[model samples]
Target chain A: MPLFLRGVALPFNKGQAPDADVLAVSATGPVYIPLAKEEADAPTLCVEENSTVAAGQVLCHVDRLPVFSTIAGKFIGTTMVNHPLYGSLLCAVIKPTRSKRVETLPPVEEPDTDTIIEAAAQACIYDELDGIPLADKLRLWRMAENDQAALRSILVADATENDIYGSSAWCILKEQAQEALYGLQMAARALRFSRYHITTMLPRNRRRALKRLIGRENVFTTGDEYPVTVYDDSRDDVFCIGIQACAALSAALQQGQKHTHTILTVAGDGVPASRNVRVPFGMDLEEVLQACGADPEATVILGDAMTGVPCQNTHFPLLPGITTVLVMQSHAVRTPQPCIGCGRCATVCHAGLLPYEIVRRLENMHYERLRYLSTTSCDGCGACSYVCPAGRDVATQVLNANETRGTIFLNWGGVENE
Target chain B: MNNITAPHIRTEAASRHLTRDVLLTTLPLCIFSAVTYGVRPVLIVLFSILSAIVSECVCCLFRRQSMQVIRDGSAAVTGALIGLVMSPMVDYWVPMLGAAFAIIVVKAPFGGYGRNVFNPAAAGIAVLSYCFPQRMFTYPIASSMNPLPTGMSVGDEVVTSLSLAAQLRADATPSITRMQLILGDFAGPIGATATLLLVACAVYLICRGTISCWTVVPYFATCALVAWLFPAAGVSRMYGVLAQVCAGYVLFTGVFLINDTVTTPRFWFARLLYGVSAGVLVMLLQRIGRVECGCCFAILLLNSIAPIMDRWSWYVWRYVTRFLRIRQEVKAHE
Candidate 1:
């Protein structure tokens, strides 16, 4: 091109600030303190009764939940402290509500271990007789639970179970199922199998317990022509138990259910003591921090000591994407060093481009030549930068060299940190 | 509202950067061309580049668009390519005029860059070869061999043509040493003569990731395909492909010129078509017709029909897809 053409400049990235009012100075610290084991012995009282706090500044924060501020303040703290998405609220938060005043539990809705185990055992017996994935067994169990709901659910969808269960390894197990009994009454059936080849599972022990309790052969584990006995008198109750067992069993077999409520194990040497406590999903980290008594300002929120995203704020919704939220002092700022021409970029590039030569091109302002070298083909897997002996931000540099577009969102020009 | 980018970087893959890399890749050639022929060719390239940019700018202005042509590095490339095809020792003003004619008439008037029909450089060379044969080949080329200490020197004539080597084969003269060609001990184009220099630039371009070896490999392979099948070098047919490739700019131009994404065919078969035809052209021009300047002319001619070939092939593909769909529907009905 003739020397007259000029290039347009793109806007640079501007990160967020601290708790110094959004309209005013953007504050940038997260001063806080981790609640220690020794703190249990101290006369625990509200630390921040009412005080405006800076980013990471303590507003009666602690590692555990169930605590309030002795001083007066608003909170600005990260929530991920070892446990992601939720907090493990061990102690009382609302000053231990009077147990006598609050009456009644939420109705023993799902049943305890023994009854569940009994129902679960029945479902397993049914499974062994048919050798099907839990979903199929649940379908039959649900039909037996409420015949009206079953007809509605099945008739609303005209496709057959075979069609739904595509040809997969699971189909092999499906073939072992007893033939479908599609009359006014489904037939009682069981799969034929030689018993006890693989021994000492739950069936052996549960059978012994059930026999002792019911006096008759109450357990249905054996392939005795019919895995389930049709008891006319107790039909509804039996169906209920079957449905309960099926639901519980299906939940267990699910492959991809994520952790909603989790136990935060705060037991690192860096932490005061190792202890596990349950926390709800999406609980604010400031609430847990106030409970733990850590200075949010000094604590650096690390998702993990290894691979973690560093950010200044914890007000963002907690996501399962993070693993750990370590609280430590921030690392010092670093400047990039010039490439020593060590040829490390060349050695590590998977596409096999001489990236050092590429750097030379960039240095020489030959910006247009990068493509023929397969620079666009770079996957940005970070292997090159991760292994770079010079520790140059090689990955970041490569990323900077390429142009790609992503979704856009609102940025109310200079959003003041709250 | 807000735009965030991880440095939304443009690929050199665009005509812009591809054009720039082509310029950079051909820099040694340009310097060699200028030095050998004197700065007349350089002046011509400079004028054509300016004219192309100006014409593109004028079009962009009339269309109320930003002039992207210059930033894309295409106009400069067209100019340089024209400069390469022209003779070294022409009077300074002729190249400049040819460049103006090439850019204004061949490139910009037809919507510029990717939109142009004919190869701008080739058209310019064609025009000049007809208009001024004296300037293009005044000095007997069989006598320009002594290497200048710096740039391109025009002293007493020397047997400098690489075509001389091709022509030498019939006369049973000892073939020009491969080392001399590769290392550039002999003389030819300011840029294209040194097989090694071209290789180094090609390697740099390939490593830069602008061009793929797919086009490069296949183009030469197609050229060699015919050569290989009929042993022209008196060796085994397999070795004929290598011999044909190693000789002259067949390898360099096959990898670079015929492989140009914008002008060249895109689909492998279409590329094969381009390659194979170009191969035939090169063979006929060199061995049969005995045209000294075959590579550039073959490429320019083939480039003219590349789009039509691609479109025709795509039409065939679409027809097949539609036919299959209809057949499936008929079977279902039955």
Candidate 2:
């Protein structure tokens, strides 16, 4: 029998104070929009410098997710800034006209799956939870629509936080319950599927309210383990969307506007107070921190602290998929001690591979030994890093090996290539 | 890039911290030994630790590796365990030379801490036992009196002629009570004299999760079972098992030495099997009167065979599962 996964229970500040309030934070400064500059598939820029653009207008195109201007503004040249998703790229700096002139889409009546996919592609409704574009997800679902087993369940994941310190996914599910339900209902209608599940990490007191709003049978409560709440049963079958994504879908059908505002959580040590706030996308993160009453001396980070990319500075604008704005005091660097083979990293790994042994094999360049050890099964969850007593970066080492070796080490079962 | 690596947060317990915990757990054993067998054991510990560190530093210099590798505290652990298992009445050079040899020959040449195929302390003790078979078997009488240094021992009250193993070999259970044997009144290695104190230390290590029950539990269980099933000549099964467990450093060696993380297999079942194999080997060696504390030799031998053990178990399991799958598919076709 497969066992329930064991993970490190993070010491989250589970106070009622932060969970009780919802603060409205507005971003007013120039929004810096990042353009992709990867090797072969960089985003093609559409709008140039000094060009005036309206809200929800397409700024650039990268695959199906068209980059939209969240605010109506004049394109005031480009600035080089570190993006949370793309690395260091040139960002289109826009001084918001601050006018209510959003270029809107016409609401579709009795929309089918194709209409929904087309609308999502035009609106740039990405699956803000896993950073996968909604168009891409829809395209996959569209291809597999004939095979009934291809799609199993549409999970509206609200339980993203393993600790009490992370995102506002659960908060959006609770406060905007109808909107979230509407989003799921629209997707179900578009795709013609019945099964739906909502997962949450809210306290017991708050659970009853959420269950009453979205039926108890459809809701499941879990601890702070991240991937558990996201893909509880099967990784391939289950397609998950955050409460923000669901609410965005609802808005696209009802309000006739493309993806604009984002609901994000601002919390951590250096912040004065932790609160869930809804701010327009492309708003400067520094302006958001000011509105949320964050201390200026505090270091600002975007996304989850465990797996999230650290922002070089707060000059960049908040994007659609960016969920949490973690403000905390800078931690001092600690020199890592050697691996003592305690096997704690292996014990806590969600993936069944031994991370410490893999790292040891890598250090010695024992490629054949690593291949047998299933080094490819590592999902880069950082659980090994969390439990390592020797302070070794087990995840980074495994990720490095996987990236460098590619498929050669991973194809053990003779199934991956096919 | 940040100066600090990824995984910005880490567990509170480090390798150095765990090694320090193991060293700290040995304190009670050390104190009990000092009160029973004088400061000779303590002196041996000090000498072994200093030599181990010096040898490791020299090895790092010779390899052109950074000298910063000495800060992990594994050397201190190996040295202390070697000291704890040594004969208190043996020459002072025994522990010092043994510890240095273990570090340079066994540990450092294999590329340091986690890379060694054998437990350093166990290998050291095994080598010492082979070199000076007569001095290695000598045991100091348990008392508050300070032990005379080796080569100047003359007083009858200070030392004993035959240890518990020697007594067991002659088919004559020592005249001391079982209670005396358990409570450190009998003659043995300094730290091995007190069964109660060593057990208490093992319980602490297990509770703190520094030591695992997978290794220590199966070891004692296997040792007891083997002794009970096949008692030695001229002793009841009960007495044989109790004597086997209580006599000669088996308890200390099982808890501390055999359970070394690097020397054992990764899987829990594999670890249990390793312990069981060591227990069987030790009992077999003891029955034939080959070694005094057979656990040291058994653990070192088992450590060398651990990789083979892992490979054998994996292949067996894979073939069994594949057979089951094939039979099920055949049944389904029928």
Interface RMSD of each: 14.1, 1.9
Across residues A1-418, which tens digit of lDDT does each residue of candidate 1 receive? 1111111111211111110111111112232222333434333434333334321122232332222221122433323233322332122122211121211112223433333233333222123112232223334444333234332222110011111001111111122111111100111111111110110112245336434543332223322111012222211222211211122233322321112222222212233322223333334555544444445664434343222334455543333223234444433322233343323344345444445445545555566655544467565544445434334556555654544211111123343433
The digit string of per-residue lDDT tens for model 2 on B1-334 reads: 3443445455677777778888897788778777666676787777788889999999999999888778788898888888877777766778888899999999998889977889999989888888877777877666676655535233455556688776776777557677776776777776776888888888988888787887789989998998899876676677777777888767778878877888877655567788899888887776674668777888888988886675555446545655876776566445
- Provide DockQ values for all models, in the order shown: 0.03, 0.39
TM-score of chain A of each: 0.33, 0.84
Q: After aligning candidate 2 to the native by TM-score, how far in Å is the CA of A385 from where it should be?
A: 2.6
Residue B263 C-alpha lDDT in model 2: 81
> Which candidate gets the maximum lDDT versus the true structure?
2
Residue-pair clash count for candidate 1: 85
Candidate 1 stretches greater than 4 Å from native: A1-418, B2-16, B30-68, B137-162, B165-175, B228-252, B267-273, B287-291, B308-334
Q: Give model 2's clash tally.
A: 1
lDDT of 2 by residue, A1-418 (tens): 1243756666666344335656665546787666655334446668877888988888887664678777788888766766656667766777877676788888877777778777767777767777676767666654345545435545454555664366477677667777778777667655556656676767788789888877887677766553353345443346666767777777787777788777778887777777778787767788888887888887666666666556557776677677777777787655566676676665567655667667877887777676666667777777788777777788899987776553554557666666
